[model samples]
Target: MLLLASVMAHYTWLAIDNLDDVSLQIQAEQIAENLQLTDGAPTLRLPENLQRAYDQSSGSYLYALIDSKRNILIASEDKARDVFSALSAEQLQRPESYFRLINGDGSGAPYYVLQKTLVGRPDLHVVVAQGHLHSDVYIDTLLTEFASHIGWTLPIILIGTLLFSVWTIRTSLRPIKDLSDRARMIRPETRGLRLPTSEVSDEMLPLIQAINTALDRFEKGFEVQRRFTANAAHELRTPLALLTARLDQLEESATAQQLASDIERMSRLVAQLLLVSRLENTTPNLEPGVDLNVVGETVVALMAPLAIAQNKAIALRRASAPVTVLAMHHQLEDAVRNLIENAISHTPPGTEVDVWIGEDGSLAVRDHGPGVPADLRERIFERFWRGRERSGGAGLGLAIVAETMRAHGGRVSVEDAHDGGAVFTLHLQLDKSAL
Candidate 1:
C-alpha cells in the first residue's frame, strides 16, 4: 500500500506540473492567435473570456505584447509590462522562463512566463505569465483533498488484506495439519496405516499419495520378514523337541548334560524368535490394567527351579499397595520374565537376584555381579547384542523385553545398583483408574 501510494503521488505530481506548463502554453498561444496588425502596429484583441481570465484586477494572470526593439506594445496590466520588460535578452529569446518582479506594484511574487513569436508577425512576441502562488495553492488544495478522502483509507485496506490472507492460508492448510497429526500415529505395529487423501488439496495430493505408496511397500516387506521369522521358528520347534527327546534317552554323562543345555538354549532362542514375530504382527490390548506384583510372583514361581539349580536364589519384593499399569497381561509377564532371567544369569552363585515391584508402576531386577558398562547399556537392548562376557543364552531376551515395553508404551532402563551389579528397571504408565 505504501508503495502504491508513493507511485500514485509521484505520477500525480508529474501530471499536475505538466498541466501547469500546458495551461501557460495554451494561454500564450491564445494571445498569439488574437494578435492583429493594425497599420503596422501589433495589437492583442483577446476574447471576453480570455480578457476576464487575464483580468488586471486579479493580479494572478498577466500578458504583454512586445516589439522587436523590446518595447512593450500592450499588456493586460502595468505589472505585466514590468515583468516582461525586465527580462534579459537571453531569457526573452527562450520560449519559457520564470520571473519575480520586485519593482513598483509588482508584489515581488514569482510567475511562470511563456514567450511566443506572433504568427506571421515575427517581429512581435506575446508574453503570458501566471503567479506561482496561485499554482502552489491549487496543488496544495488538491493534494490535501486527496489525502483526506483517499489516503487515510490505505491503512485500513492494508490491515483488512493482511487478515484475509492469514485466514485463507490457515483454511487452505487445515487438511495438511490433520494429515500431519494422523501421520504421527503410524508405527511398526500399526500395519496398513496410510494417510488419507480425501480432504487434501490438489497441490498436496500427489505427495500424500506417494507417501502412502511407500508405506504400502514398507508394510509388505515387513510382513514378509515377520512371516519368515514366524515360520522358521515354528519349523524349528518340532525338530528341536525331537532332538531333545533323543538326547534325553542317553543324557546321564557330563557331555550329554552339556548337549542338553545347548539344546535348551536353542529352544529358548526359537521361542523368543516366535515371540518377537508375534509382537511385530499383533498389537497388544491395553484396555484393562495388569498388576506388577501378580506378574512378578507368577514369573518368579515359574523360574524358581532354574534359579535354584544354578545355585542362585530369586527374591520378589512386592509393593505395599497394588501397582497396576496399562499393559497386556502375557506381554507384561514376558518382559518381567526376561529381566529376571537376565539378572539370575549374571548374578553370583551364592548371592540372590532381587526383584522389586514399586508402587510407581516400576519393576526392578537387581543382580549381585559386575554391573553393565555405561557405554553398552543402550546397546544391550538391541537384537543379537551380547555383552563382553558372552553368556551362553542367545542375546534376544533383552531385545524382546525392550520391544514388549515399547509396544505397551513403556520404557526399560539399566542403572548401577546400590551395592553392585546392574539394575534393570521397567517403567510403565500407571493405570490411574485401576489404582
Candidate 2:
C-alpha cells in the first residue's frame, strides 16, 4: 500500500508539472516571436497593442523574455515589484514546461516559468511567468480538514464490514447446521427423520437426497426387526411353555419320555430362532472379512449330532474348497445352518446330504429326496412358506438363510441338483483380495 501511494503521488506531480511546462512553453514562444521581428540580438518589448490585449484577458500570466544565457530581458512591472530571481536553464527544460521560483523579495506570488527557444536566433529565449499552480495545495488543505473529521469514523466502517461478513457466513451455513440437527434426531426410537430438502442449495441436494434414502432404509430395517421379534416370540414361546408344563406334571415312563422329546423339539425350535435373530443383527466387523467355506464347516460341526440322530448321513463333497467372502461370523453361519438343516430333513435316512462350495463364490447343500417343484423352489425362501405335505419343522430355515445371505450382501436360491434332488445355493460377494 505504501509503495502504491508513493507511485500515485509521484505520477500526479509529474502530470501537473507537465501541464505547467506546456503552458509556459506556449507563452514564451508568442512573446519571442513578436519581439524578434527586427532580427537583432534577441529582445523583448511588451508592445502597447499586446499589453492592452492581454490586460483585458482573464488570467495571471506576466510575459517576459530572456537571452540564451538565461538572463531576464523584460519583466511585467507589476511582477517586477515583487519579483523573484530568474529560473535555471535546466529547470526551464522540464518536460512539463513549468518551473517554480520562490520570491527573494517575500512579496511575489509563487510563479511557474515557461521558456521557448528562438527559431532563428539560437541565443534567444522567450519566457512567461504565471501565478502559483494552486490546485494541489488547495486539495491538500481540503484533505487535512477532511481527515480531522474522518479519523474517528474509519473504525466504524471496518467494524461494520467485519460484522456483515460474519452474518453472511452464518446465514450461508444455516442449511448445513439444520441438516446436522436433523441427523442427530434420528435414532432407533425416532428413525423416521428425513432432512428437509425444500431449501437445500443445489450443490447439497444430492447429500440431502442420500440422507433421506438412508433414513428410509433404516425405518424399514427397524420395522423388520420389530416384526421378527414379535413373530419369533409367538411361534416358539407357546410350544416351550406347554412342553415345560407337561414335563412338570409327568412321571418317569414312555409317556414321560415322549414329553421330554416334545421339550427337546421345542428347545430346537428356540435354538433355530436364536440363530435367525442373531442373523438379523450380524454384519462384518472388519474389511476383507471371513470366508464362507470355513463358516460352512463350522456349521456342519454344530449340527452333525442332530443329523446322526436322524440316521441321515451328512458329508462335505468334492473339496468344498475355501470360499472367500466378506461376512460376519454368526450371519454366514446362519445361512449355512439353514441349508444343512434343509438337506438333513428332506433326504432319505441312508442318502447323504452333501454341502458343496463352488469355484464362483457359491455354496450348495443337496439332498437326494423328492425335490421341490420348479414353481415352489423360488418361493421356498419366503418367510414361513411350507411346501404341500412338508412337516416336522417350522418353515423358517430357508427363509432365515435367504435373509442372512441378503444381509451379508448376497443371495440364496434353490434348484434341482445333478442327482435330481433339491439343492439350496447361497452366494455372497467376495472381496477382490480374497479372490
Candidate 3:
C-alpha cells in the first residue's frame, strides 16, 4: 500500500508538470503570433490582456524582442534585460524555438523560458519567460492535501483488513480445537468413540482419517493385551492357592520357610498384575469422597504386623481435620497400602517408617533406608523396573501406586527426605464437600 501511494504521488507530480509546461508553450506561441513586422523590424502588437499583464510590476510573465545587431525592439520594461542576461551566450545564439527551465533576474528563482526566432525575420528573436514558483507551490499544496487524505484512509483500510483476518483465522481453526477436545476425552473404555469428520476441512481430512485409523488399531491391540493379562492372572490364582495350602501344611522347616516366602511374593505379584489389568480396561469410580487421613491410618495398621516382623516400626501422623479427596474407597486404600508396604520393604531393621496425612488431601510415606538415586526416582514408578540395590516382589508396588493416583487425577512423587531417607508424596485434589 505504501508503495502504491508513492507511485501515485510521483505520477501526479509528473502529470501536473507536463500540463503546466504545455500551457506555457501555448502562451509563448500566442505571443509570437501577435508580433507584426514593419520595415524588416519586429514590432509587438500586444492584445489587451497581454498589455495589462506586462504593465504589472509584480507580474510573473516577462517577454523581450531582439533584432539583428542585438538591438532591443520592444520589451516589458527592464524585464527583457533580465531574460537576455539570464541566458548563456550559446543559448542566445540559437535560432530554433525551444523551452528551457532556468533561474532569471539573478534571484535564483526558476522560470520557464520559450525562445523563438520570427518566421520571415530569421535574425529577429522573441523570448518569453514565466515564473514557475507559483505553479510549484500549487503542485506541492495538491500533493500535501493528497498525502493527508491517504494517510488516514490507508491506515483505516489496513486496520480493517487485519481485524477481518484475525476473526477469519480463529473461526477456521475452531473445528480442529473441537477435534482435540474430543480426543482428550478418549480413554480405554471410551476408545470405541470416534472423532467427528463432518466439520473437518478437505485439506485436513486425510490427517484426521489417519489418526482415527491408528486409534482403531490401538484399541484392538489394547483389548488383546487386557484379555491376556486377565486370563494369565486368573489362571495363576488356583495353583497359587493350592501351593499356599501345601506350604501351610508342611511349614516347620527352613526349606518350608523359604518356600512360603517365595509363595507370598508370587501371590502379591499376581494380585498387583490383576489390579493393573483391571485399571487399564476400566476407569476407577471417582463419585465418592474418601478421607485420606483414614486411608493412611488403615494402611499403616495393616502393615504394622509386617514391619514388626522385620524388626521395623511403622508410625502414622494425621491432620486435625479430615483430608477428603475424590476417589473410590477401595482404590484409594489400595494405593495407600502399596506405599506403606513399599516403605516397610525398603527400611532397615530397627528403623521407623512414617505415614503422614495432611489437611490438603495429601499423603506421604517415608522410610529410614538408603534413598533412591536422583536419576532412578522416576524409573521406579514404571512397571517391573527396580533400583539395582533393591529387592522386591516383581517391582509392581510403586507402579500400582502410580496407576492408582493417575486414575484419581492425582500424582505421586518421590524425593529425598531432610533426614536422609526417601519420601514418597501423593498429591490429590481435595473434595471440598460431598454432593
Residue pairs with colliding backbones in model 2 are 18-96, 21-96, 21-97, 21-98
| TM-scores for every predicted model | 0.70, 0.46, 0.66
CA RMSD (A), model 3? 10.0
State the lDDT of candidate 3 residue by residue for 20-90, as single tens digits.
Answer: 56655666677788887677656677789778866773647777777655566777767567556655545
Model 1 deviation from the true structure expressed as Cα RMSD, one decimal place: 10.5
Q: In what order do the candidates fall by TM-score, top score first? A: 1, 3, 2
By the lDDT metric, which is better: model 2 or model 3? 3
lDDT at position 216, candidate 2: 92
lDDT agreement with native, every candidate: 0.83, 0.69, 0.79
Error of 2 at 113 (Å): 74
**Candidate 1 residue-wise lDDT, 1-435, digit = tens:** 677678678867876767657767888878777777789866667799768767743777888887778888888888777767676666566544544444344566667777777666666777777775556667786677568766787788889889989999999888888998999989887767899988678899899999999999999998898899999999999999999989978949999989898889889999999989988877667856688899999999998898999998999999998888888898888888888988888988989999999898899999998998898989999998888556776889999999998898889999998789999999999999975
Q: Record all residue pairs in model 1 with backbone atoms less than 3 Å apart, i.e. clashing.
A: none
In terms of TM-score, the best-performing candidate is 1
Q: Model 2, 143-192: lDDT tens per residue? A: 65446754455577668878988999999899899899888876543556
